[model samples]
Target: MPPTRRFRLIPGAVTVLGLLLALGVPAARAHGVRTEVLAGPTSVVTVTHDDGSPLADTPFTVLAPEGAGPFLTGRTDAHGRVAFQPDRPGAWKVRVAGADGHGAVVTVAVDSAALAAPATGATVATHHAHEHDHAHDEAHVHADAHAHDHAHDHDHAHTRDRWSGAIAGLLLLLLVLGVGGVLLRRRRG
Candidate 1:
């Protein structure tokens, strides 16, 4: 090709290269959805894939017996477990799902006895009933605090993911447009 024609190809080539790089960026994803609920004073739900691998960082919601809305929501831990203390005794629903569309909705039965039971130190305090009760109460408070922290962390992560995706898309669009503008100016001149 002539010198002028060859120069115009450089802008086009750069745009193609930018597009390839942008397309190669990996996106955040949640990709599994099976659940097992171990109910007691505090219900621990374990989410995994059909192949039995844990679905780490996946989102989940705990619905009350009335089902007005989600009583609690958070992402699973590295082991794919999320625990919640049900306030009232009844049937509570736990929904574990991912963006990839695999998830399970489990109904956990909680009785008044479970709610009345102490949360921890059951084996250590066989003789001191009062100490056991106090220990349980303390453990319950700790679990609530931890759950609240998890919820906050999930919110932060969600906001960060949204902003990152938007920025990536905007940068890609600007890159394409800037390259196109350069080629157009060269052709006109």
Candidate 2:
């Protein structure tokens, strides 16, 4: 009876050891993905394999604003690096995937001010035109002043709209985190 019990324990120990090795080896060998924004409009993404070697030729896609369709698609170079210029302002998503179904998604935020910089010259020209019209007639001067005031108000409204959108996004994120935390606590309990 004692010999049989010992034999059973030996198999159980071997099974436990096998399970640990199977679970731990892959985790220890997992790779990491990293992204960096270069000067100007370029962004660089890098992928590394389990042994800290670059995973070259990995295919990647960039989506403008999260959940939007792909704006650009390409493969990484020999250094596991892909560069792209974000054309729009918002949260851009970069997705990299390998043949083995391993993938990563990283979000990069773009400032609206940066995108609007090129349009400043046009805006100044329009302002000068408005001033020229203002000098034409008394009646036209009154109209031009009113138009200027309206444009100023529109600018304020535009700024307010941007702020409101940002606040709404933040609130939604907080709500999601709160719900997730509650669910996790309940699951633990």
Candidate 3:
């Protein structure tokens, strides 16, 4: 093949490789999730994916400040929610595990004042403590099905924005490729 012909295939091949890589990126990524807490009459915890989907029916364990073991153990409801009544004011830890090896530990700080005024519909502050943040490594099992827990003062808009950003990125990639193709054709013809 002539030098020009051989080099002509380069741009097309590069574009093809780039497209393949871009398309495969999402599929190769592992799913990530986060958690939120609502402290009211009962301390409620909500677990959700970064994309804002509920992780329904997932198992959760709540550890009280005074206990060596779980204070309450159960699976999240369809909305990824589980609740526990704190007997005392302290830091309560809620560990939620998904089926696919993903989970989060949320630390909720409960005050005596908050517990005392539960009738006021008060919400408690929650701390994000991921599995990696643990002092010791603990083996966890993830659930395949989805579970979602409802809580107060949690926003779902962030998830929608994330999806929009991804779509915008794909559109931008297509625009760049189109312009490149046009320039290449103009150069040849």
Per TM-score, the best of the predicted structures is 3
Q: Candidate 1: where is the Cα deviation over 4 Å?
A: 1-33, 121-189
TM-score for each model: 0.45, 0.43, 0.54
**lDDT of model 3, residue 13:** 80
* 1 against 3, candidate with superior lDDT: 3
Clashing pairs in 1: none
Q: For residues 62-134, write the lDDT of model 3, one tens digit per residue.
A: 9999889999998998877777888889988899986778888888788887688635354634333222222
What lDDT does each candidate get? Answer: 0.64, 0.56, 0.66
| Tens digit per residue, CA lDDT, model 1, 1-189 | 799998999999789866764553322223324455556677777666533467879888999898687999999888777788889988888777889776777777887877777673122111101222222323432447765674345335543554576568868987999999999999999
Clash totals, every prediction: 0, 0, 17
Indicate the TM-score of model 2. Answer: 0.43
